[model samples]
Target: MGQQSDGDAAVGSSTEFQIRQSFQNKEEVVLSVKDYSIRQGIEYRVLESDHLKYHRKCKEFDKGCSWLIRISLHARKGTWEVRRYNGPHTCLATSISSDHRQLDYYVICARIYSLVRADAAVTIKVLQEATEANYGFRPSYKKVWMEKQKAIAQIYENWEESYAELPRWMLGVQSTMAGTVTVLKTSPIHLGDQVDESTVYFHRLFWTFLPCIEAFRHCKPLVSIDDTHLYGKYGGTLLLAIVQDGNSNILPIAFALVERENAESWSFFLSNL
Candidate 1:
């Protein structure tokens, strides 16, 4: 699809010209994918996704879940992202091509990232060529989303050994324009639950701190300053932080683990995370 001079009426025009009916609901997409997976007997998992992410603003919303197709077909860019939103629930796919030129580029890259399964291994060379052919557009920016994904997997495979099974490593993928963005957050069900120190460390590194940094990755890291007290256990409130990386998916490069969470422990973590 090419760019329309004005974006506001693009959807209406597309429907009038090409689409015969309203876009499918997110639930429908999920059901379709799920049904297909079931029929194929593909071992898979649903990813958290947002109803708002997969489809255009339909003036309404529905529930759904994103999926990782256990079997990946050979695809070029825009192979998946341009498709309907499918989900585990609340997993938001990034919109590519707000402008027509970039649309092809984003559509393919985003789709590629979305399909990555932790259990599968792929080569970077193959992924790169596929993106180029699929999108049919040479990206204006130098982008390598798969490389980022590989880096994240390495971090997880390496660090996860330390944590027997406290926090679970879900999935990591790159987003449009932004490359691969890792999604790792806490699923703590109880207050006094035992967790892995490395998981805790990585949790802070990938999910917590990077938001503000990523917002400004195009710019230099924008640093802010503040002060607080140490109250509980540390004579006062000790400085606690959550870190995430925006420039890349929320995966850690390396870490040093411990038995439990503590001030002295976290203090050392703050230095690296």
Candidate 2:
């Protein structure tokens, strides 16, 4: 109703009306630089490739320098920069992911820009030329570092104070041996201090010969049993033994001291056996 119809004048009016009714138009979509940058980050400008800065690939070489640069740059991941990596510059689609085997690179590397511009100090470290070469941030980087800190805190608590029970005299020794055992291990001491072996055999046995019999039970036999002396309070050596194949090893089973290791002691030993 409002405008002229030049196309309709050329075509029959009826044909023009039919064409207009039947035709459906398609829309065009164009994503501008600003839109991409906003979605990605300020560093997107530095990360994107420019033909002038990057030369074309060469057939002579299996790979190019740009390819190497692209491969080295890793991605950023995790909560902190702990495990994350912001790699150097490069060409090609060599971006990184949590798993490096998977090279899932973004067409427009928005994430790379987001991480690079985050801290200004990085700008000075990664010059403009290098920043553009490597694109895309690596993921899963930040999560691994936090776990190690937790382990060290649990394993190294106070070590010196835990062993305080040892007495100053012993220094490092933990247990005590009394009576004759103490005399053998240390030196002479006071009267009431404790008479080691003397108390057991002297006071307990009333100074009888019974204690010698007790010592014989623990003694290992010399096997080269000897009886050079015939008399003394106690004498004669016995064999030492251990059970083997249901028979005793030719070692001592016990000791039999005598008034003198004489025929009398041998008689007593045979009688006991």
Candidate 3:
């Protein structure tokens, strides 16, 4: 029986399985199997799956391929252990496609979660190259882009959750650092034909750190304002207020997030600034 070393389970590492190998849980077993299938350019179909066991066979099992695996939970050991394995697929490659059936967005996201978390701005081309380098196959551009989005969403909270946490985050900042200024605006929540007065939705936010505000007193009198579009699950504009120091170093003093760069939004940000 083969066992994966700690390094073998790390990001960008190769995945392989052997009979009698144990996994922490069913999810781990499934992920390793999927990774192995994708790396070897093969497809598999689940033959049996349940809370206590998992079994899979090659997609070409009926076409003379004798590849299959079975894993079951070892109640005494509190682990999932592979019971049988016939791998290193004997079936011919079905096609020359760049994509594989087992290499879906979810798998890609899991594989690249750490990279995306470390740098959310990493480009899709970079992710594609990384995937190719790791698995010897490059997925479609759209697929890699979608996978990056999912990875980001997983690292950071989803849009709805993030919007809901804005007020709490602002309060946390203010509590931790006194004199911090934060202005959060919310609109009434509307459901179908009725308005839910008790509920509110995030509309806009403006904030300036106490340190930034104090630093401005020592900086040049001139302030530069600019707005940039946000590219995420929810579209918005980020407004920034910056000032130059005596040494010509630019310092950001205030920031705001609004629906768009309109007269009203600009007015709101400027008033807060």
Candidate 4:
């Protein structure tokens, strides 16, 4: 009988690699977990669920129990799979109010920021409500907006500081070698032949070291050119010139940054080349 019980336990236990050929509904998964809890002499509750996944926690969640599990629909097999599991509740109380496992705004902010950076048009109001439903408290619209700005700054750094450092950084680039060049043009607004406070700006920066240019003399006659957009507070474009050597190694000959990618900008970049 003891050996039979051990066999039953082994059969019921879940492994990460388990796969099922038959599909099961939410009720079936919950029943299986309920049976498991009964056998173990404990209780659990469904924390969250969607069409594709379910997350569960110990009934003692509000009392600080850390036991939890996550299950999801298997993509290939059309069956339920145990994606995660944590065992052995440690709370002293079996019932309490206010979940300890609930996520705070700081943690929510980090995730919210990531989502917004990936898709700036994501609806924060919808996210706020979703967060409230999932974690039991809603974050205010102002808080979510602040976190979005913080996340953007974290990803791109301080935009004002970046602009201020441009001149000094440009000097450092030109100090490296002769024949290198960097230019800044500010298009100031004019009112009836008088300059105004408003302005539009353009930066025509270019750089090529002596070694790179000299090395290109021995390279093949063919060249490759390309351009890419710069993701910054003030968006712009970058243009590049590259050549190949006898060993087929890529040798970058020149690079430039322009206010926009247009015929005039390309002409200016190529003229400096």
Q: Give the candidate number with the greatest TM-score.
A: 3
Tens digits of per-residue lDDT, candidate 4, 63-169, equal 77877878788877777777777665565433233322223334345446546656765677876765555445466677666665565566545677666577787
* Candidate-wise lDDT, in order: 0.34, 0.25, 0.83, 0.63
lDDT of 2 by residue, 1-273 (tens): 111122011111101111111111110000122222222221122232332121112121244322111111112221111111122222233323322321112211222333333432333224222323432323232321221112111222112322122123233221332211111022233468665544322100001123334444555542234444422123324311221222343433333333344565455544443
Q: Candidate 3: global Cα-lDDT?
A: 0.83
TM-score of 2: 0.14
Q: How are the candidates ranked when ordered by TM-score, highest leading?
A: 3, 4, 1, 2
Model 4 regions lying over 4 Å from their true place: 1-156, 176-179, 190-194, 197-200
On lDDT, the leading prediction is 3
Tally clashes: model 2: 23
Better of 3 and 4 by TM-score: 3
Candidate 3 residue-wise lDDT, 1-273, digit = tens:
112233133322234567789888776777788788877778899899999999999999998999999999999999999899886688876736877888777567766676777788989998898888877788899999987776666667678888888888998999999999999999898889999999888889999998999999999999999989999878999999999999999999999999999999999999988
After superposing candidate 2, which stretches have Cα over 4 Å from the reference? 1-248
Task: Count clashing residue pairs per candidate.
Answer: 32, 23, 0, 0
Worst 10 residues of 1 by lDDT: 8-17
Candidate 1, 55-113: lDDT as tens digits: 22211123333332221211333122333323232333332332222233323333344
- Clashing residue pairs, backbone N/CA/C < 3 A, model 3: none
